[model samples]
Target: MADTPQNQAALALQMYLDTSASPLGSALQRAPMMNIGIDEGELATLPLVSEALTGSQRLRATHAQDLALTVDVEPDPARHALVWQMQMAQTGEQPGPRVHNFRPLHIALDGSLAPDLVIHTWRGGAQQSFFPPDAITPERHVLYPRTTAFYQDGTFTIGTHGGRSSDQYMPYMLITTADDSGGLWVALGWSGNWQARFVKPRGTSDLHLTIQIEPCDLRLPSGTTLQGPAMALGLYEGDAAVGYNALRSWLRSHMPALPSSDLSHFNTWTAMDANVDETRLLDAVEQVAGNGLHYFMLDAGWYPSPPNDFYSGVGNWRVDETKFPRGLEVVAERVRQRGMEMGLWFEPERAYHTTELATQHPEWLLRVPGREHALVNFALPDVRAYFRTFIADLVQRLGLRWLKWDFNIDPLPYWQQANDGGLAHLGHINGLWETFDWLRSTFPELTIENCASGGNRLDWALFSRAHVNFANDQYTNPDCIRRILGRMGTFLPTERLNMIYGPFQRREYDDAAWQVLEGSSFGVSEPIDNWTGQFRTSLRHHLALHRATDAYRSGHFYQLTPDTDDLCAWEGWQLHDPETGSGVLALWRSASPEEQVSLHVREIDETRSYRITDLYHQSGSQTVRGQQLIHGLTVGLARDAATLWTYHLVDGEENQ
Candidate 1:
């Protein structure tokens, strides 16, 4: 089941047109020319104007109204992944915004394709059930879509739209056969709201997928060029893990490099919340400097005096001299003295009625007929330019090296039927891209972490340019952390996922430490002074273990266990570096009765013997042949315990 074009299915499209033209077929011999009507007419398939195989396994198609698209397919030996891009340019003689129901991309298979396959979609983000700020639980209330769907067999179509904050929910879907033999992975590259569908034609084995821009009423002026997001489809013939790995490979190859930084972050929000000051921050920097930490971040409330909070003063990005009489730069200097980079958190997309931006530039906010809070109209050229210059200047002047960019609220009542035309949310997202691009270019070394009211904004569209993500606001809840980390890791690099470690005053203490071991970048909210000797020593030990197992950053990932709703069950994952034959496995047992579980490791060379080192216990080392390891390795753990083990190929033992 290699991903070569010869093995993977090719697209044979049937186009519906308004003219006396016959239905276009893939057998046209040459690329065909089809005239398309701008109005929503009888179009059974995508109204393709032209198509060309752009590269090996890649296809490009253009439609009327200057809608250009490129579909790029990359075939791994066992899997074929396809990514498509859409761009719209103005067509002469026609002027207003164009509205059309773009058909879904179709994938047809002969009757030989199996009938037992399942279609899956994510809840977009943790806050999907909540529309505006009112319905949202301020901290950690909802957690159903832990970003997964149960594995089942049977042909069906499912999709999800909208996201953490942007337009489209989550932009990816996973479909797998009942036997896990093979399936397809679909992804969209747009940052704003979008729509996608996975449909298995009734009574037929064919699966048809369609992904298109949403809020289709989005207005683009005549002669204006609007770039839509791209959709990617991947076909693989192995298990879901095999398919996910291929998707990850495609992302790594195409997505922008993560912003430059060591990314060992420390945030104030986890510990101090909105209560922050220069003395406490400086103290935190000095204490954590010796713990192998690299970045110190000033979370919300740093920008204003005691009276200001993250909610109201967000739009006014200014320094509150009351908190830092010597200016924010002094804190930055203190951080630099301790050899740590400085980071500041900001919620730039939202503005409350009390802020200066809302008062002075009311027009910059996206206004719905009835809503109170205004979402910044980043799509507006002037607004984007202003924030770009403002944030860039702040970073440069303060010598800041990192930014914890947060979007706390979702833009609801997005548009009014009577006034706005076209997709306003889209424009806001476009502005997001513009601002991100400007920051990247202006400060090449700056690392920007994406946070949308705690893991709401987790999607590929933002990750392509942003460095790290605030997975969720629920760092204290081990179950929540476990769910987020395990599932999000299916697509995102483990290292790019940001998790917090803290005193865990309200919950189980050991859970926080376990969470720290699982995430890519580790953060501590509490002041170092509050850390007991035992806790501090354990933190240092875990940090050292993470450093040793750093190979996990670039290694291939495999989820060894299915996610369960039960907190008592066991779950685990492995990150293995094929080149070095080294990897790390993390296992956790909640309240489950199982005292010991047998884990079947994956992707190791069967000829080599691997030596497993217990990271937590450090009590002993054991060697097992890779073949035996794959069958199963039994590890004993007390109830509600977590442990990490690092495995490396034993030298001179490869032939064994």
Candidate 2:
């Protein structure tokens, strides 16, 4: 009998953990999953003892003297994935030496598996495709859908340049054999600067992989613990999609269930931009209330700002009396009356030099040498407490159901400059988590949307805390949105990627806009009151279609189109719900001269017949055998247009 994927994955994990079974022999039996450099020597070289924790899937490795490592492993056989968290600490009577190169996931794979290995990595951010003429610098070119690949015997190191984890490179990696016979997906669960190094020896298949919180050279006091970043490993057999789907499934199941994940939002940022007044906001709320939008988000600029100086007024969390003399309560109340929830934006991490938070509590601010605006140091207990109280008070006073947390500044310089022995980033991240935890515990129904100048903080660590992520600040470009959804959906769960559209005057691409929006959890930045009758009707139709297909959105996502920036090509993706035998397929014909293209459905039962309906065009349904759908389904779309379809298995009686 052929070995199941689960069996193969379990075997791979066991081999990975078995220190005694290495071909390098018993001398290397004390191999550690994590690596740390201390004054004495490398932590992995020390004689260590390992024991399992009682009644848990956790294991502890300890040295006779000062160091110890704890690994908590969660194996999900259903998804064929192994997720684990690792932490290293100083457990001795004296302070440990400044630690160097602290890596949570440091492993060496045997050489026998090297020849066919291929590494897939992605740049994380919105401006990935804006090269040379479009963007001033080459740095702007580092993001999806421009994926980077490394072959066997290649040595490459990828990492974030600043505090935002995914600002440069995504905190995920895929290593698969060229034949697609076997593969592994690894993800780092850190929201700060992280590095992953891959080295394949020239003559052997021995692969060395390590993930670390960079610029780390911190001392561990006797009682102090240095928690390394968390790591997750997934194993799969067959094509690369199997591994991607397995990781996505595990993440969706393990992460917190966000209330806003399924709700459609209407943000006022684009339309009002900071020039908002009480009458305007309330008017906007009224328009959004019954338009299939569940949340009326009064975005940035709601806070007090000096005339023509909104960017410098972030630290002030109070509503501007000039704009909202009645306060936000009136708008919130109106939203509730109209059957929609209220959401407000806040950038608590930043404070201009003149702001009250920065002027009065300068000690609580993280400042670099020349930067005027400083980060509200979450590492300080007082800072976290103050923000928690401030946000909670607003949440209660305005009856807010959602909060958009924005961090506009890059904090790496401030963190790296801290006097603390390279542990400033770790402390600040911990504080951030603690603050979010407190907020969640206080208001069980509140939803938090994570945004860091767009997609800067896109990583598993942040996703574990926040409900949904605003992909990037590029909310106006339909072409950009299409490419983002296609590329990001490779690793991220489509339902959690918040796609914001419009306020752009491109009326011709309205269908294309709605098509891309339907591919993920979406929001509208343009007011419905200003939309044309046709556009408004299209909005309502797509909104209803979005809610109707919410179930399939959370299932396995398959990108049917290639990840490219070619304007003359068809692009598409599919969301398949295996449990319900239903799914959604979205296609985009972007400037492509070709009017017809054939799409082959994936992961469907060939023996069954499916009822497929074109939801966007309101085209009637047709029944076709799943085999035929899998073989190829002809879809005709005009240039600069798109289509959405939902398919379900036909009932036995109907099939007969």
Candidate 3:
């Protein structure tokens, strides 16, 4: 069989493991795919000792000093893309030399692939769009929500500042040719601080790309091996959206599957605040009973809170007797009786300075100067064991089916303060993975929601353990929600992307409904008692719409409008299921003055005809040829309005 572009890319990656010749010399001098800094120096300076191919998809190479690197290449022929993962380990009997700044991906592209490349990246923190114009200085250019730079560059770098992987920037990038024809999509799967550097030296066409987990300086114990975080490289042809879809497809196939009942939920934190009581919660549960919400999450305040304060009760894991005299089991039973699962929130990694846990186990705490709360050192086996028992007990006692794991404090200071040559961070992160793995294996039916100050710790490493990610905490602003959904959807599977809706202060019903459609799963934080009859009707209607379009949420997504943060622009995307020839187009007319916009749908069969239905309005349906639909479709909406239009093949052609 002829080698496709994807297979060709895989073969090119195989060259990095060739041992007969120097892997980093002459022919590959511009492309050192992996780098390691040890006590002696960079690993590239060492001679290659041996090379072996385990199978058609796996390659391994051992260099001097028993340092081995492995690459796993999986090709998706349907998408015409190659997904490759890299990991390094120490293979000697004795402990290896102290490793420093281990980088899993270190490639330097020169000649034709360097000069005209365009780099794309996204920011990952909350309220990124709320910054003022004056706040965005040239020095803080990388701090913005998103950036696209045409490279004639000296050097460019994007990375997280704190311990959480996605605290400052997302661990994903897309680099394409100037004309948007072919390039590489890179994603780092580390759940800790990660960095990516693109360096193009002066007067040279070489563009060096490197990704590493920062502060990764540690030595392996005897008979123990240290592995770097996984790095995935996806090669794509054609436009940027093609690259985005390819990466998303790869992630969906690799990551863990989400729970069957996690699609839509209701959170009580925003609604009831810290004053949650058994009576109020039971009433809240009744309000959502058969309202299309699958889970009822009692966040934060359900635990013991001193002075009725949520922040002060970080380590108090038991139910607050004063608020829930009958215990959480009562409410949990009610939720289950109503055909809904119950979820509880817990911040297991932090303890308030005044809490009993912190007072008793000060040695287990990772402290920084002047912080109100101390980070629980998961690196300690005792700590992990305690939490595993504590959490499991509560899950069984309360009949809880889901856990919303929240981490609010930043652990970078403590990790750096430990001064154990970065071993503290490494141990703590690995311990977290172990704990999560234990939970999944112990309770196969349980669902876990990975949240860290809302979306700060999201990455493939964490995604592999948890079911879904909460995008961000800024849910009140429709514009912010829209921007976050679009950016996160670029590389993440839409089905694993979750967001919160309301405490609806001043937002309109239309705006709230639009936000709900943008994500696959959502939780409402508003008090049900405050909902008017009309509001309740509208909420139910929207929830039904969301459930009806489940296929679209998991389908191939394409951004139809310019990726921008401007409030006055029209933004939209299309989700197509190629197998069934069904899809939905969702558009938001933000605050734009224009009422009508033209959208050109992609990946449609030009020879077929489609039945299009307008979901928001009672305008019935229309039949249109695929060629005409792909050419253009004019949609009109008033300012601050949004619409959902779904389409599928006509005349029994959908099966094709």
Per TM-score, the best of the predicted structures is 2
Candidate 3: clashing pairs of residues: none
lDDT of 1 by residue, 320-433 (tens): 778778888888988888888888888888887767888899887766555556778777888987887788788988888888788765553453332344456556666787
lDDT digits (tens) for residues 542-571 of candidate 3:
877777788877778887887654668888
Q: Each model's TM-score?
A: 0.83, 0.88, 0.87
- On residues 1-656, what C-alpha lDDT tens digit does candidate 2 reach at each position? 22122211221245343322222221111235566676567655544333344332555555555667665666555555556665667788987666777777766665453344567777767354341112111121111112223343456788886778888778888776556665677878887888888876555545567788766787766876645676777666667787678777767775677765556888877766777778988777766666677888888787778655677888776888888888889989999999889988888888998887888898998888788889788867799889888998999999999888988888888887786756677777778877777877888788888888788887787788888888877777677767766667766887887867874566534666777875568688875456666766777887887888888878888878665546678988998998988899888887788888888889888898899888855666788888888888888888878778899888563542
Q: Which ten residues in a row have the lowest lDDT in candidate 2?
A: 135-144
Taking all chains together, the TM-score of candidate 3 against the true structure is: 0.87
lDDT of each: 0.61, 0.72, 0.72
Candidate 2 lDDT score relative to the true structure: 0.72
The lDDT ranking, best first, is 2, 3, 1
What overall lDDT, based on C-alpha atoms, would model 3 receive against the true structure?
A: 0.72
Model 2 spans > 4 angstroms off? 1-31, 45-55, 60-69, 88-96, 128-153, 221-226, 507-509, 527-529, 617-619, 651-656
